[model samples]
Target chain A: MFLIIVEKSNEVIYIKITKIAKAGTLESNDILIMVMPNDSGNIELELESIVMQQFGDVIEQVILHKVKEMGIEGITIKAQDKGALDYTIGARVETAIKRAI
Target chain B: MQKLRRTMLFMPGNNPGMLQDAAILGADAIILDLEDAVSLTEKDSARILVRDAIKYIDYSQVEVVVRVNPLDTEFGPQDVDVIARVKPDTLLVPKADVEEIKLVDIMLAKIEEEEGYLVGSIKIIALIETALGLETVYEVIKASQRMVGVLLGGEDLTADLGITRTKEGEEIFYARNKVATVCRALRVDAIDTPFTDTNDYEGLTKDTARAKSLGLTGKSAINPRQIEIIHAVFAPTEVELKQALRVLAAMEEAEKEGKGVFSLDGKMIDAPVINRARTTVELGQRLGLIER
Candidate 1:
């Protein structure tokens, strides 16, 4: 089971990724992700929605979105994961975006 | 004096993916390993791979260190000879017993003399990974003037001690605390072992904080993702920076007034506090937190 919790504000976005697997260690079986737009838009929510819709099919998606109704310039995400997360897989595309920003 | 080195990231000698990710990880140093990470059958190939990576990679900001195979290994001396020739920032000697330290010192001295290189130009970091090694940390740290740091290799230490490497680092606490204290007494850098569970941020953060509290100058990173956490733990926060600056200013003011002692924020300030302030400034400079 995997869980994604997103808390958004005018200044930052707090994300917590929780996952559990048959494997004892998270070294190779799990993925955690968070994303934000570089140029500032409703991109974080959009990105979160897109990721959830895509990987939601393969992995569990317990996503919680907390979008601020005011000025938001940057995004900050924290992913607390339980399994091995890859950089290229669907679960990590948004994470790559976060790293890029 | 050099500023503290906070994050030392490890890259397996033969893993190109890890090597490629290292320089951009924002770690203070990158330790390319040719030891335990490589199999006996792949040792020679790993050495070549490490050498090539060193020669080609920019490593513009990160200090580069190569963990050569242990002295007893057939490939160990050869690994050192080749790496010393290339001249990375430092050489990390594994299983650094007293004998091994003496051996590496002699070999490095010989190489420096034969090649007309500056004697002791390359820094040495002795990794204490075995029970025997832990028993002789002081002698090992003192064996060579080229020694810049001492690293605790907990995984191997635990294996040697026949214990499970736990998350709390209890099994290796004695060794870890000993190495760190020894380094502090010797006035050299001490590095903590990596937390192998790379994905566990809570675990990693908690461990890094513990390592920092033990007066460790740095902690090794098993993955690029661990760099930020390590850096944040070691980096001077705004409060620390402000206090440091105040203490420094008080000292300068006292000197100007011809007084030997100064009071800062209603507390007497002395050499140790001043030294800490100066170190904070140096760290900020080295880390680019402020304009030099």
Candidate 2:
């Protein structure tokens, strides 16, 4: 799945995800997200999960919502889902962003 | 009311998985760590996470404590700033002395004023981790009206004393003894530092026994597995519970008979004995070892 959202940002993006940071666990009903900096100034998402064939779009929407909520750009989010809820995904994204900053 | 604090488990503030389940882990208190548990680079984000956790988390039966950085650090003011807005059950001031505690007290007062919370609603737990802090612990305990307890910081004290840290904990003996004594003198709870060896359950048990013998009300736990042992070690024993019940019954009878003193099994039971019994019963009730 792919997503593209346009928002005005004139400030220079100097701070990036300096390291490979991760959140959540590989446990049942959990999702592990690996977030890193992207050079293309676009939010790139790569998802892998058994449920992706069914709930791929919904999961992408959740990740996109959190990325936009944090005002985060130029980031790559790789989410490995195992039936995690929206709250869990949002929390993981927030933690990854905090670690990146 | 002074709630039970037999086991205060430390959950890393930045770890949402831990924070989300902290209250349900059967600890009497949960300390969200924004200090040593979190790295320097992630301090700001950790504080923000902890602030949101306190606001949103349903910590109904558990007391929530935030261990903020020392006031001397750049993060101290920001930690307090977040705390003022969230208003946790208590603030665990790390590496604290009289001056530092007073500073926190003053800032809490100002924040309470600005935030429109009740003045002195947020309690303070002074963590004595330095030579100076241990030396002046008496003043530190009395520095603020909101003071609830004092905790010994074993690792920091060992580092400050230039001694090797050990599971045996001989190096922190004097500091632990002094903190317990001062806390007793001030009628405050004395909380011991965590036993760092999470893998060694035997060592943790022995350490907790030592802390109980020293008259410390509680000990901090770095892991959830340690909580049950801490609570078990601190629970009122069966014999003590029976004695407390008898003493309370006798006291009530004496009061009804207009008597100030009484004899139980040929031993005198007076104000001090009754007070001790009351404490035992209260502790038992709080631990759920006895009927309320």
Q: Report the C-alpha lDDT of model 2 over B1-292, residue by residue, as the tens digit.
A: 6788888999988776787899999999999999999999768667866786777778988999999998899999889988768899899999999899999999999999999999999999998889999999999988999999988989998899899989899888888889888898899999999999899999999999998898898999999999999988998899999999999999999899999899999999989899989999998886678989
**What TM-scores do the predictions have?**
0.70, 0.81
Best by lDDT: 2
Task: List model 2 lDDT by residue over A1-101, tens digit each.
Answer: 34444443667443456677877667655678888887787778888776878888888888888887777777888888877656566767777777777
Q: Residues B50-115, candidate 1, lDDT per residue (tens digit)?
A: 775677667877889999998897999999897887678899999889889889988988887777
Poorest 10 consecutive residues of model 2 chain A by lDDT?
A: A1-10
What's the DockQ of model 2?
0.17
Clashes by residue pair, model 2: none
In candidate 1, residue A62 scores what lDDT? 25
